[model samples]
Target: MQIRTNALVSSVKNFLIEVGGIIDFTVLVFKQFFKKPREHKEMIKQAYYAGNKTFPLIAITGFIMGLVLTLQSRPVLVEFGAESLLPGMISVSIIREIGPVITALLCAGKIGSGYGAEIGSMRVTEQIDAMEVSGINPVSYIVASRIMATTIMVPILVLLADAIAIYGSYVAVNMYSDVNFQLFYNQAYNTLSFKDLIPATFKTIIFGFMIGLIGSYKGYYSKRGTEAVGAAANSAVVTSSLAIFVIDLVVVQVTELF
Candidate 1:
């Protein structure tokens, strides 16, 4: 019994240490975030990779999500003979909850892992040290670029995904009962207020920042081993993914109070 208790306490201690370190790392990044960002061209390149490169994946996923959701929900709504409400219902769901969370999680997997591995490899190889020797800020150049890229791009991607998902729903709705394009769009937007849109978009920006920050933190402080590179990447995905759901819960709770 004592042994088990000690193990549990040890686990909690390690977890808290990790949380404290991440908080400090985030603060450092924020300090750099406000300054005139370095590597203007690098930020653009990172943005392209994080945002533009992600379009195809998001587009296809959004379409499938909309179509599948509509098809699945239609049968249930139809049971009540309320199939007409499909557009508004789906739009509400995709916009208010589904869209942002899905997009952020996808980014957590793809972008987060990439950041960790790239940064971790640099850390293990002494590249980050070399930058410091040259009087360069590795944290700002690499970490800030990624955090800002993801911070800026993820929201844009979420917007695009939300619109594309609505389009997919339109296609699905038409397959069952014809809906005029304008009417379908109008109904979709009608159910959405500033309350839904603003909070959802805002949370996604935070989500993006968290993903990039966590990934960068793991990589930036990685241990000096080749194996640490892969560990960083894996931990990036797991940690950022968990962070998404946690932030999502808080956002939802805060939105409810509004």
Candidate 2:
């Protein structure tokens, strides 16, 4: 009983420590973000890296996912003579669930890992300390800019992914049956309510923020040595992906409440 009690206490203490670290990190990031003169140049460059360079990855996956989803769903949907509902069903699935979740998971793997490795290497190499000695705020220059880029770019990627995915669905549907572009979208658009669009988009924004925050935090505080660099990247991706799943569950619950 005493050992079990001690273990429980240790778990609680660790949880509190983690919560405190996140809070402190958030405070520092806000301080950087609201500094008198913003670092527009770095932020822009990060945005390009986060959004533009990541576009092809997002697009290819989205297109394939849409094609697969439609094809897989066809037999089930057609069995009940519900073929006409294909566009609407696919749209709802893509916009409400698949698009946001898949895009976020992909970003968490790709972008999160990259940020973690880049900053973790800087930390391990003492470049971060050198920047501070040279009078540049490393956290602001590194963390703030990356976070800003992610917060802006992930949503745009989600939007693009949704469109591409729907187009892929259109192609799939047309291959199996005679469906015109206008008619396919007419059914699709009619089924998508503001509820689906707003919640999904909002959650992706939160996912983006968490992805950036987790990556930068892990990287900036990485342990010494090269192995720590890999550890940071791995932890960043794993932790960000878990956070995305958790946030998604909470969002789904809250949105259902509405």
Candidate 3:
């Protein structure tokens, strides 16, 4: 019993220590964000990777999400004679929650792992150290730019995914009844308000920030080795995914109160 207790305590202590380290790292990145010689070109490059490179996967995922959801839910709603509400139901679900969450999780897996491996390799190669010795701020040029890229691109990706998902839902709806595009569009549009869109988009920005920050953090502090690069990539994916769910829960609860 004592051994188990000690193990648990040690684990918690290490976790908290790592959390504190992440906070400090985040502060350093933020401080560098405002410093001179803004890394606009790097930021844009990161954004392109985060957004354009990730879009095809998101497009397929979003379409499947909407199609599967509509197909699964349609039968139940049809039984309850609520089939008319299908468009609104799907719109609310995809836009208000599913779209953002799915996009963020995908980004966490792809962009987060990419960031970690990329930076971890740099660390292993001593590139970051070389940059520091050359009077270059790694935090500013690398971390801040990547974080900003994720912050800007993830939300845009989420929005694009939401649109694609809705179109896919419309396609699914047509598989059964001959619902007109205009009618489906009206139904979906009417059900959505600024309240739904704004909060969802806001949470996605937070999701993006977390994904980038956690990935960068893992890579930036990774142990110097080839094995450590893989470990950092895996750790970044796991941590960023967990952070997305936690942040989504908090955002939902806070949004409910407003």
TM-score of each: 0.97, 0.95, 0.98
RMSD of each: 1.1, 1.7, 0.8
Local accuracy of candidate 3 as per-residue lDDT tens digits, 43-152: 99999999999999999999999999999999999999999899999999999999999999999999999999999999999999999999998998999999999999
* lDDT ranking from best candidate downward: 3, 2, 1
**Ranking of all candidate structures by their TM-score, best first:** 3, 1, 2
Question: What are the lDDT figures for the candidates, one per model?
Answer: 0.92, 0.93, 0.95
Candidate 3 pairs with clashing backbones: none
lDDT of 1 by residue, 167-199 (tens): 999999999887899999998988888998999
True-vs-predicted CA distance for residue 247, candidate 3, Å: 0.4
Clashes of 3: 0
Candidate 3 Cα deviation (angstroms), residue 205: 0.4
Residue pairs clashing in model 1 are none
Clashing pairs in 2: none
